[model samples]
Target: MDKLKINIAGLELKNPVMTASGTFGYGKEFSDFMDLSKIGGIFVKGTTLHERQGNPYPRMAETPSGMLNAVGLQNKGVDYFVSNIYPEIKDLDTNVIVNVSGSTIEDYAECAERLVGLDKIPAIELNISCPNVKEGGMAFGTCANSAANVVKAVRKVYPKTLIVKLSPNVTDITQIAKAVEGEGADCLSLINTLLGMAIDINKRKPILSTVTGGLSGACVKPVALRMVWQTYNAVNIPIIGMGGISCWEDAIEFILAGSSAIQIGTYNFIDPAISVKVAEGIKEYLDKHNISHVKDLIGQLSV
Candidate 1:
């Protein structure tokens, strides 16, 4: 048996390590730095139903132990992805998952329906973190009912594995987790960047163009781990934990906390080949502890 292999719904991963969307680009960008097939999967950048210009300049701000990003899910739209990006990444050796985002339920469903015909794409991470313009710009993942509605709509059209990416900005992360699971989400990945901001004391102004952005990196791991553990206990579906995961030890902690898989986000900018290193480190950790398979380590925290 492959010790590191695990299954997320029906999508099989060689290991529990995957590069987070928007961080790893389309996997092709990191091919020269590390073997694309060495890791379990690669979630391409966020794709929307329509093209977006994204936030204005200075949308990114570096923080103390993390960073704030208001990239705004900028992409060339789903149709462009189907026509151009898909062909370029359809043949990679590893699982190529797309991270789908939209401003409305219809947009989410239509975008997901476009990817259904692609043979190489195995799964999609539904990013409910985007603002719902029709609903007064509130994020769909922030409300249980709103989260369920979006997942329910996407589920109707997306027949393959559906992984809902939960937002950390919610009052209760588990509530949203259960809501989506009830609506047919195959898996969950949390806690998407925490709401945060930065200041330029000298200029007496906000750092990011949007004044506030999503906080990520080592600073958010504790919150991510806690949320993952909570959601793991709340829902029966698998959880893909991510936030501040930067190393193998961090990845292992997430697994013990309840993540069947973990994604490396902000840290990817620091080390282009970190995903493969984390995978190797995980295998070594398993060997050292006499753990026969990585699955045995899932939610194995002693509490």
Candidate 2:
């Protein structure tokens, strides 16, 4: 059998596969379709200090090979998660990472302070790629200074693994990646969702109520892979690369390009068992290639 285990900032994952935030609600939702214990980790929906209703109707729009969403970080507060969700899955066979979002630095810090003591939650992923809010979110992630500030502030309180989730709307992703890496981020997740819009030519109006949304799925793979490769060169910490990853081939590209692990996003919307399929595919490849460990493929690129 192949060695699938890998450590990302001290968190031991059974494999290098995980679900992106916002795509997978709490792990309990998909318990019926697939066994949560079969995968590496679960980065659940973005949680804030309080409950969020998210954006108005039509929060989702389909593109050629991808989809756009303005689902404004709708989630129950972190306290609710600790009280209701944690006790059930704390002993599951996978890592439980909470994806957090906030409207201000203070909000983010406060949330982190609360989660720092909860040993059940092994890690926290800061969701800095949301664009629908009036303040914070993707706005903070686009700039190098602000992006680092949030990570630094959270790092002060969150003693465990801190994964900074980056936005894909930036001009140069390496600048932001280097900034966060310097500020004590334990790991990173890239290419959240590309900024895009859809117009209804007939009514001469936009499709989403918010007028714009974050695009995710197969169409954005190339753009995401480029960003991941660039960031991998820039940062010293591990990267949880994602964006348009739907199959084993996609995951392999990310690993070879320097991603320590890959996150499955939009694929879950279509196939709930996509993560499992991807894990199986990775194993098959390892066996055929005579590889003893998945980590051997990390950054094994041709010159």
Candidate 3:
């Protein structure tokens, strides 16, 4: 059989297909819908030190090719996750990753420290670039120094793989990527969500309560591909490319652009089975092209 396995930040995934945080709830929600074992990895919703109610209502709006969300990491917090949710999914078939978020550097470190010894949890994806929160979310991610500070602090406590999620609203994504890599980030996930908004002409006001929300879906694919390519060349660390990925073709595009793995988002709301289809589709394409290993396609793009 062709080897489809790939490693990112020391976490070895059976395949490159993964579910994006916020897009995939705590895994239990989708338990009846699909086989969790078939998935390569599952990045659970963003977890914080405390509970979050998220933004006001009207937090979502549909766009032409994508969707906008200002959910603002509305989760039950890490304490409940460890005490309650973790046990239920400790033995799943895939790599279960926690998408950790925080309002401050201490919050991030404290949360990481909490997950250090969990045998079932192998990694945590630091979501430093969430655009929905008004406070500390993307503030630490847009700049290199601030981003490094957060990673440096958490790196000291978090022993497992550290995946830093990056926001697309920046002057140069590579600078941020290199900065985090320098500070010892284990892996990178890019183009978290471009800041975008829509308006209701009849009401003469914004569609979302936050005025603006994160833009994700096929609309952001081209931009995501470019940033992934740039960051891949900028840092030696492997990248977990995501943003607007909805199909196997889109997944292969990320691999060619230099991502060791890919994440599926937004599309989850449309079809819960999309990720399974993507995983199967990728294998079919590889076999058709005589590619023996998925790694062979990484950065194989030709001009």
TM-score of each: 0.99, 0.96, 0.96
Task: Arrange candidates by lDDT, descending.
Answer: 1, 3, 2
Q: Which parts of model 1 are misplaced by more than 4 Å?
A: none
Highest lDDT: which candidate?
A: 1
- In model 3, how large is the Cα lDDT of residue 159? 81
lDDT of 2 by residue, 136-178 (tens): 3348898888888888899888889899999988889999999
TM-score between model 2 and native: 0.96
lDDT of each: 0.94, 0.87, 0.89
* Candidate with the larger TM-score of 1 and 3: 1
Full candidate order by TM-score, most accurate first: 1, 3, 2
Q: Which of the two candidates, 1 or 2, achieves a greater lDDT against the reference?
A: 1
Best by the TM-score measure: 1
Error of 2 at 87 (Å): 2.4
The TM-score obtained by model 1 is 0.99
What would you estimate as the lDDT of candidate 1?
0.94
